[model samples]
Target: MALLNKYVGITTSDGQSHDGFIAHVDQDYITLAIPTNEMYGQMNGMPAREATYRQFGFFPGFFPRRRFFPRRIPFGAVTGLFLLPFFI
Candidate 1:
């Protein structure tokens, strides 16, 4: 639970990959704070907001939650866990 709200990468058995904050976690599932992608902006007809692509660090994944929310991945489906250094 220490990794809650911290950045992480999850790869599930279905070959899906995600990179975002650990929005929620439990024995049953893990939720990632998903950022809407470029198409989301164009689809919503919202003007592109200036991106703080480096808010936490130089890497794009560091502070990625923009127009964010949680996405749940069942723990049973998780094939790998890639935790960020600070969380350790």
Candidate 2:
């Protein structure tokens, strides 16, 4: 359970890679906190835009803000699991 709550990368049997925080783990599956970039306006089919705050010194460059949603992956389908460095 050392990987719990840690951001990590996962490769599945189908050869697809996924990145997320290890939210929960159990006997059969592992849940990942998948990051999504959905905001107030974006959900309404409007073009997503980042609001920059020069006074607050907040510049969302390459990595924009993210919200996490849980996704469950069965252990049987996992081909690889590794740790990754994540910063907000």
Candidate 3:
């Protein structure tokens, strides 16, 4: 999947609206990195933040499915029939 760089508006636990750039995403979470002002004493702590799985929206597309490989061949005897002709 492609990494996206976009602004997202999120409502915090305190019922505040925060807008920030999305830094990374996973199956269950998103990381938002917000820039701080120089006047805020250099913003000592981490700038990036995280949100829950349900906070974001998705665009319409197909999701990938698990790959399955057949374990048993119905006719093991016929396998040689299909390959033997190629060798001859």
**Rank order by lDDT, top first?**
2, 1, 3
lDDT of 2: 0.79
**Cα RMSD for candidates in order:** 8.9, 6.6, 25.3
The residue-by-residue lDDT of candidate 2 on 5-87, one tens digit each, is: 99999999998889999999999999999988774332332234546333334334333345887889999999999999987
Superposed by TM-score, candidate 1 places the C-alpha of residue 53 at a distance from the truth, in angstroms, of: 30
Q: Model 3, 68: alpha-carbon shift in Å?
A: 43
- For each candidate in turn, the TM-score is 0.58, 0.67, 0.35
Whole-model lDDT, candidate 3?
0.36
Tell how far residue 77 is off in model 1, in angstroms.
0.4
Better of 1 and 2 by TM-score: 2
The digit string of per-residue lDDT tens for model 1 on 12-85 reads 89899987888877889898987665333222322234353344343333333357767899999989888754
Q: After superposition, how far is residue 17 of candidate 2 from its true place, in Å?
A: 1.2
User: How many backbone collisions does model 3 have?
Assistant: 0
Model 2 Cα shift for residue 19 (angstroms) = 0.6
Model 3: CA > 4 A from native: 1-3, 12-14, 39-88
Backbone clashes, candidate 2: 0
Ranking by TM-score: 2, 1, 3
